[model samples]
Target: MRLNHALPPDGANGKPVGKEGDLVVRDDELGALGNMAFDLHSQLSTTGDLARQNTFDAATQLFNDGLEAGSALTVLHDAWNTKLGTLKEACAHISNHLDYSKAQHAKDEHDIQTGMKNAAGKAMTVSRIYDYIK
Candidate 1:
């Protein structure tokens, strides 16, 4: 039986291999990268906002139509009669896109949360790309 804790029999140095380089942000290049990331996220978020609005409108119509029928049973019946799979797929796509946007936003926010030196009133971390750049 072989022991799992046994060291390598030959050319093995047990020390950690290499240093992960510290990313130094050049103010100019960092600014440019930050701007690009912010713009991409903002555009994605805006698109999601529009899509969310459309969803609200459609869902409201569905709800209103369901309610307009005379009986509570009709409302209950309509609720159960959903094409929920199709709706779930649509929502999943939107949610996936929103998650992507939030990921980009979170990268900058992580910098802020780590107490990086930045601009004043930078607490709206997701929206403030300038604070995160340098």
Candidate 2:
């Protein structure tokens, strides 16, 4: 059988040349996910900032004792913001990596197709010679 013709039309393992798997990150889907992560980070960070400002304002209006509580709360707020930043970075990284993978897969598929075509052409040449000799 011709090597080129024997394989699936799309590519190896039934996947298309540059398509993403259901479990793997897709370009469009991952982009959306990254956007959502950014939006969440923005919204949450803004809310946290406003809440902290309001609490501090209220505490200062009340008495001197509230300063210590506000100081303690700052630690928790910083930690939460740090975590949200990490999450946003991770989503962006995933989206970028998947986009790179899709391009690489396409290049690899093209190489495979070229190799198979060459092999098939060579085989045909040899077979034709043998048939002519007989």
Candidate 3:
């Protein structure tokens, strides 16, 4: 018996499919998102470091002048640094993962196309393709 792999326009669950179908990946968009994440990571690392240092210096000066608020400010600075570090790490992970995904997808597609070619280097027919899938 022939296998019917085609789904209806609305898909098996009756939900409308995307313009390019469910699994389409736009490489350019992925690259753009990755670049934005990398930029955020870089900005947070440099600017966040400068801001933290300035706040720490001010807090130290206040403490030296016998102000109680200096201790509170120091605590605030520490909390802010911890939050900033977490955000920077998340941005770095996103950037790195997207880059790896794009490269890996390209490699997978290359391997699949190479494997599907016949011994004579011609593309496999539709019937032969079904045999592999089955």
Candidate 4:
């Protein structure tokens, strides 16, 4: 007959077989990655600013030419400029969201620790009730 002890089994040499359902997250590493992405996008915005300005300056000069006022090329240039503006806005949003995520992750990690401590305390209190009842 086999007896079932409550404690988990240990591997060879009496070391505990690795914990089950453990989620080990390296938040510091993740936050650093997010910060790097944010910094890269900020640099991209600076470079894009100069490029956009040059592009618009050329487009305006072309549009100002009397021969091209009614040309389809002007319309195409305007559409492209609109799309570029939207793309820049999207990049800014991405950077902002990543910054927010990094802050939230830190908050979440703290909350998890607090919750675990509270749960352990409550479990110990409940376990003591059996001794009082006996």
Candidate 5:
């Protein structure tokens, strides 16, 4: 399966040569993904709490009335809560990891730029930079 058609094809020089050749990700993109994950986590937590509160009384009453469904409802509620917790944790992890990745990449770029300078504090030429990479 062609999973990623967006990637550029190799050029004659064995280097990627197309619009998507360079692996580029903007800070805003990472921030937006993180924000979305955080929003999903918040929404899930809020909805889960509201649903649990709305059902708690009914579940308790059914159990008090000694119905088989009460036991079933309690079990279902517990299972739903467990799944919801897992989902929330995953969303939190995604958000936190993205934030960390964005900051780390920025730092990496800064370090790379800083390193690409001569001892006299001049920026390295393109050919010189390519030589170092090669």
Candidate 6:
């Protein structure tokens, strides 16, 4: 719909004529007056930064951004959400693989160590028996 009226190009020397029944006085044109009203609200806000604000915090600015430049912020939001979900899933899968690898490695090491101990004990017993019989 009628997003911005822009003060009817501000006349010849960048001044509003302020005439009665002018196109600048239409419904959409009336919104330009809101910019002046919100200027006061901006000073009273808790957050100092202007870019990061909620819908209610800086409604005029938010609406202005939404209406500016044939805007398409919804696409940006959807892309961000999709990428975030993918990253989360990838991290979870990597964590699971890491846990499984550690468990398998520990089990393999334990088995190799147990086998070596058994072999050494048997070799020692056989050598002792051979010496005893000699």
Top candidate, metric TM-score: 3
Candidate 1, superposed: residue stretches over 4 Å from native: 1-24, 67-134
Candidate 2's TM-score: 0.44
Error of 3 at 49 (Å): 2.0
Clash list (residue pairs), candidate 4: none
Question: How should the candidates be ordered by lDDT, best one leading?
Answer: 3, 5, 4, 2, 1, 6
Model 4 lDDT per residue over 24-84, tens place: 4465755666666667667656764565555566657776775464355557656766775
Mind sharing the TM-score for model 6? 0.35
Worst 10 residues of 3 by lDDT: 14-23
Per-residue lDDT value at 23 in model 4? 41
Local error of candidate 5 at 16, Å? Answer: 6.8
lDDT of each: 0.50, 0.57, 0.85, 0.59, 0.82, 0.46
Candidate 1 per-residue lDDT over residues 5-101, each given as its tens digit:
4334553964323433333434455445545555655554555345444455555666677754335444444554354334444555555555555
> Residue 9 lDDT in model 2?
67
Model 6's alpha-carbon lDDT is 0.46
How high is the lDDT of residue 47 in model 3? 85
TM-score of each prediction: 0.30, 0.44, 0.72, 0.47, 0.71, 0.35
Candidate 2, residues 7-102, lDDT tens digits: the string is 356456754333333235455765576567556656655664566556555555544565566565656556766776676667556656656666
Model 5 spans with C-alpha error above 4 angstroms:
1-23, 117-134
True lDDT of residue 78, candidate 6: 47
lDDT, candidate 6, at 116:
44
Ranking of models by TM-score = 3, 5, 4, 2, 6, 1
Task: Give residue 12's error in model 1 in angstroms.
Answer: 6.5
> Over the stretch 1-134, how does candidate 6's per-residue lDDT look in tens digits?
22233445545554334553344223333333444334433443423323333323344555576764223444444464566556555544554555555566668776664544233564334455456569
Q: Write the per-residue lDDT of candidate 3 for residues 1-134, one digit (tens) a residue.
A: 12245456757665444433455558898899999999999999998888787899999999999999899999999999999999999999999999999898889878786678778988887688888889
Poorest lDDT segment (10 consecutive residues) of candidate 4 = 1-10
At residue 119, candidate 4 shows an lDDT of 38
The lDDT, on a scale of 0 to 1, for candidate 1 is 0.50
User: By the TM-score metric, which is better: model 1 or model 6?
Assistant: 6
